[model samples]
Target chain A: MKVKAYITLKEGVLDPQGKAVEHALLSLGFQGVSGVRVGKYITFDIQVRSEAQARDQVEKMCQKLLANTTIESYQFEIIQS
Target chain B: MKFGVVIFPGSNCDRDCVHVAQTVSGNKVESLWHKETSLPRLDCLIIPGGFSYGDYLRPGAIAHFSPIMPEVKAFAERGGLVLGICNGFQILVETGLLPGALMRNVSLKFICDRVTLEIENNKLPFTCRYPAHSLVSMPIAHMEGNYFADSETLKRIEDNNQVVFRYHGDNPNGSLHSIAGVCNEKGNVLGMMPHPERVAETLLGGQDGRLLFESII
Candidate 1:
């Protein structure tokens, strides 16, 4: 099965990269942008059999490696396709 | 006192750290490779700054999984003194040895210059030689030195007196609350963006950074 994880800095944590991107976009003639927050999207292929197992494994991965729980959070979804 | 400095594949400041520790502490400093599973018995362990693994993904990302990290974690858990400087600080964050993460500079540029730092907490084993609120000038060279943490964590750190250093004048990286350095709850581990080793001698421009190493001794 394939799983996708969305990792982002927790709300209220300053996102400097996101802000810089927003500034660059505005400078390039893009307007009406209020804000921007950047994040990481990771896709992994695992051998898990069930969605429950996938979720558990992915959460463990996030806690141990994928995310810095002190400032960021991660969520993963198992894809059937 | 004996000191050990971890050397990752792309670490450029290991020699600098070794030289400073040797000079200031008057001790023999050992360079431990990242693949080693054991750390030498020592009075202190230092993770020096540099582009570890060329900072392939994010700063300190690839180096976090280095084989020696587990031993480093164990050393910290045993209340051993650990100091991470600049890229070392980022590695500490990546290893979960310290709170918060270092994001890109708010200005989106690599910052390299001498800046003043306020010694916020002098109780740690690393900063015992400095007085509270003492201003010391040190050089910081990094592209991702902006520190970020959640509000609750920030409050907890403040309450626990974990904040050890803050920017004295203009905040260079837009770090939250101008935090330049922080210690762990046990006060044995410290991570900071400033390069104290770089300014440890008068010939290097100033000797203010010597106090940090002196404190450890």
Candidate 2:
């Protein structure tokens, strides 16, 4: 099975890179851009038999290595296709 | 006394840290690679600054999961002294061994310059040589050096006297309370944004950073 994890800074945490991108877009004549927040998307190819097992393993991966729970949150979904 | 400096693949300041530790402390310092799962017995362990793992995903994000971190955790839990400087500070935060996070500089640029730091709490082993509130000049080189935490957590850290060093004169990175360094609850572990190793010698224009190493020894 394949899983994808979306990791992002928690709400209220400053995202300077995203803010810079927003500014650059506005500078280039793009308007109505209110805000931008950058995130990371990570995909994993794993060999798991059951949905429950996949969820457990993915959660463990996030907690142990994929994300820093102090400032960021991560969610993962198994891709059936 | 023996000292060990953990060297991640991308760690650039490991040599500077080793040099300072060896010179100032007169102790044998070993450079421990990130792949190693065990560390030799030592009085101190340093996580030096650098773009660890290329600072991908996040600063200190990938390096935090290195095989040696488990041993680092165990060493700290056993009351061993651990000091994380700059990128090392980020890794400590990622490892959940320290609170708060280091965000990008408010100026939106990588800052590399000398700044004054007021020693907030000299009670910890890392700063014991300095008098409380003493100002020391050191260089801070990083893009993600802004430190942030919620008000409640900040209050707790303040109450516990964990806030060790605060930027003086002017804040460089917009860190909350101008905090440049902090210690864990036990005070044996320290994580700070400034590079003490860089300013450890007078020939480097200042020796203010030497006291930090001298204190630990």
Model 1 lDDT tens row, B20-125: 9999878789999999998878879999999998987578877899999999999999989999999999999898899988988888799998899999999888
Q: Where in model 1 is the C-alpha error above 4 Å?
A: A26-31
Residue A60 deviation, candidate 1, in Å? 2.3
Clashing residue pairs in candidate 2, if any? none
lDDT of 1 by residue, A1-81 (tens): 899999887877777778888888999989988568788999989987788898899998888777777667788889886
The complex in candidate 1 yields a DockQ of 0.59
TM-score of 2: 0.93
Q: Which pairs clash in the backbone of model 1? A: none
Docking class of 1: medium
In candidate 1 chain B, where is summed lDDT lowest over 10 consecutive residues?
A: B55-64
Give, for candidate 2 chain B, the lowest lDDT window spanning 10 residues: B95-104
